[model samples]
Target: MPKMKRGSEIPHWFPLDVAGTIYPSARTRNWNYTYRSGFLLKEEVNPGLLRQALEDIHSRFPSFFVGVRNGLFWYYLERMENLDIVRRESTYPCRPMNIFSRQSPAIRILYDHRRFCLEIAHCVADGGATLTMAKALLARYLQLTGKEIPPDSGLTDLTEPPKPEELTDSYREFYVKKVGKPAPDANAWQYRPPQVLNYLKVIHGILPLEDVLPAAKARGITLTDYLMAVYLYAFYLAVPKSRRSSRQIKVSVPISLRNFFPTETLRNFSLFTNIGFDPRAKADFSFDDVLEAVKGKLAAAKTKEAMQKLLSSNVAMIQNPLVRLIPNVLKRRVLQIGYVLAGENKFTTPMTNLGRVTLPPGVAEHVEQVEGILGGSAQKRINCAMISDERFLHIYFSGDTKRTEVQREFFRLLAREGIRARVECNIREEEDVE
Candidate 1:
């Protein structure tokens, strides 16, 4: 018999949300679609303090603490009695959550040295939701350590009950008037980078935000647009000149649904727009050409009208009686196929920018860096994720390949523009498998 930790909250079980259902149904051995988001603090994490933080935050973020359960119609969440306490990071980031067994929680709080990460299944929440949870956990951990965080530290107070709105599916609420059916990116050219070891090679390129902000401003584009252009251009450089099969070098950028719709639901409430240029244009396109094309597409897609239509169409599909009637097993199979073909396969690669991450002064003082990682897809060998703090903007490149040519070219492009990057990698120098 184990004694419950003090300040622990009663966990409640619930059904998977609209967006969550698709992830569990479509997940596979090679394509789990899992993601990791966390902060690197200035000090080593205390497992005991982190456990307390988890228990405290679980009470506040009940929506995030449950385990996955199989239902007749769909997969659901079941709250468990005990939490799998914070443990040392033993493997790669974004490993699959053992949802079928009660042994695993939907999200795992992991620590290694100064890094405290939240490895979450895509089923429970998106990056934004996870970010909020991470901030709250860090705040509570700091509070326990006698560090006083401000009242408005952007951390959710753990003393209060979970908000009713936070548990609701905001996607179904804001969506209205379905416009048109969504299409797949079957024609998108997928990159086939050389395969190396089974482990992911994550390269973190730390650069000063000031170095690239001016470059983006000079192009009259946002920083994200500028970064996207740099990546697309890097991919262009990596592509063999003779291979002109890919019509466009598409990059999938996720747009947060909270921007247009007003909702505090921590569940998945984001949509994505694939923005890129056709590389097969009559004239060989320059870097500026790619930047301008990406800028135009992203600018147009960010509008309220564009987002509403996209969300509404997705809701319409889920709301369809026909979609709901399919058996869970059959639904899983169909979704697995649909996901491989229409989902990430459409884009040459996907890049997510969490944008600028701000912390309360108390917590910010102890944080060294923050990073976000998205696993690669079947079609795309590597995916890019970005996060920025007060000092630096960190871009992480994760893939199964050993080749650093793309990463080298990417940093070189930045250096060419006076945006110097301090590069670090996980693998040892002598153990170059490639």
Candidate 2:
């Protein structure tokens, strides 16, 4: 096995793996997703203990310590000089978990400037991997602190993971190939608010996950319905009169396909379901009535036909090899047109309910709670995320700087409605970095 390299070898391979010859594997390309959280440590983070934790991280997701390419997806698994993995450190800058993870490897760890806050980036693991790493680290901390026993680490339960063939290979093929697109030289996203006075931004705040559902029960709606109502209502009110006088607006709510598909793996497994509100119908409606409509839309988005059609669209794309390789430039152009056609007619924001996080018991000694943030390539419309624990909800709002003010206000409005939500800003300029 080759040793761990210090930096990423972007030229390692293309359209195949460097580690081995290409196989007709239907697995998705190793895409990158950033998941990070902040937590307080009762004590200072000891370099030694932290180092041990980093090694522990490697034991499970070691592939993260190495680089990946279109074909071969692995690091030299052998140890170098009995001290380090092959091709150890290159030139990636130092991150929070610099000792075990690469500064520029597929994965990274960064520290929050102000506190013992740790932010980890999992280039390989998706949202599911983030949760897994967080749980593992939390549990290890408990052990280091001498607080609790090791949490259950069993994955032998052969019950989950969707069947591979069942996945829409077309979606997998498209998503990765799209990544190969040569991003603009500036790397800056282009977006203009509908108008100066009319802006749509993410609202951040935590609501008791338990409270949300119970509150819905009282109102005879599901938690998803109640939250959707709030989001759609806020969005409708924000529409400029110029636009309000015209068409409908919809929100792209994402639904996870974990259960629907037999696979429970960390692979990308989500589909967007657009929900729209007709101003004519909603303008005269009360919040309760809107809630009912939201509930109905949520129900319809999950029907067998909805998913089947979506799958068909994705699968159809894979059947065209020529279309898949039309160069990233052409693909971006296609996407731009597609985005235009989709219009701003759907939901103005993306709200993802990570749902209540349940970790294996005894992991983080004296466990508190775990929450995360969701940021995307687009700098416009904020991506709002909420994850709940037994009592508290962790809400994260992230978007381009242009949307900050509105995001804060949205949280304030939620609190005004007596929902007991707290907004925490993760702005680098505003907050002290660790």
Give the per-residue lDDT of model 2 (tens digit) for 1-434: 11233323322222211101111111112212244554434455454554555555443433334433321222122111121322222211112222223234534443332223234333333454456555555555456656655424542111222233322222333332222222111111122353211222223466775555666677777666677677666655444445454444455666765546555344345566766566665447556666666677778768655665565454445336665565544544554444433422333566677777765555433445555665432323456666776677776665533445445445545665567766544433444222
Candidates' TM-scores? 0.93, 0.67
At residue 22, what lDDT does model 2 achieve? 11
Tens digit of lDDT per residue, candidate 1, span 1-434? 12334334533667777778778777656655678899888888888989987876776777777678877777888876567747799877766667666776777878998899888878888999999999888888888878888887767777677777888888777867746555444457777868654477789999998888888899888999999999988888877767647577888999998888889998898888888788877467778888877876788878888788788877787778997898787878887787767676678888999989999889999888887998655556788999999989999998878777677778988999889789888767786564
| RMSD to truth, every model | 2.9, 9.5
Which number leads on TM-score?
1
How far is 223's C-alpha from truth in model 1 (Å)? Answer: 0.5
Residue-level lDDT for 76 in candidate 1: 87
lDDT of 2: 0.46
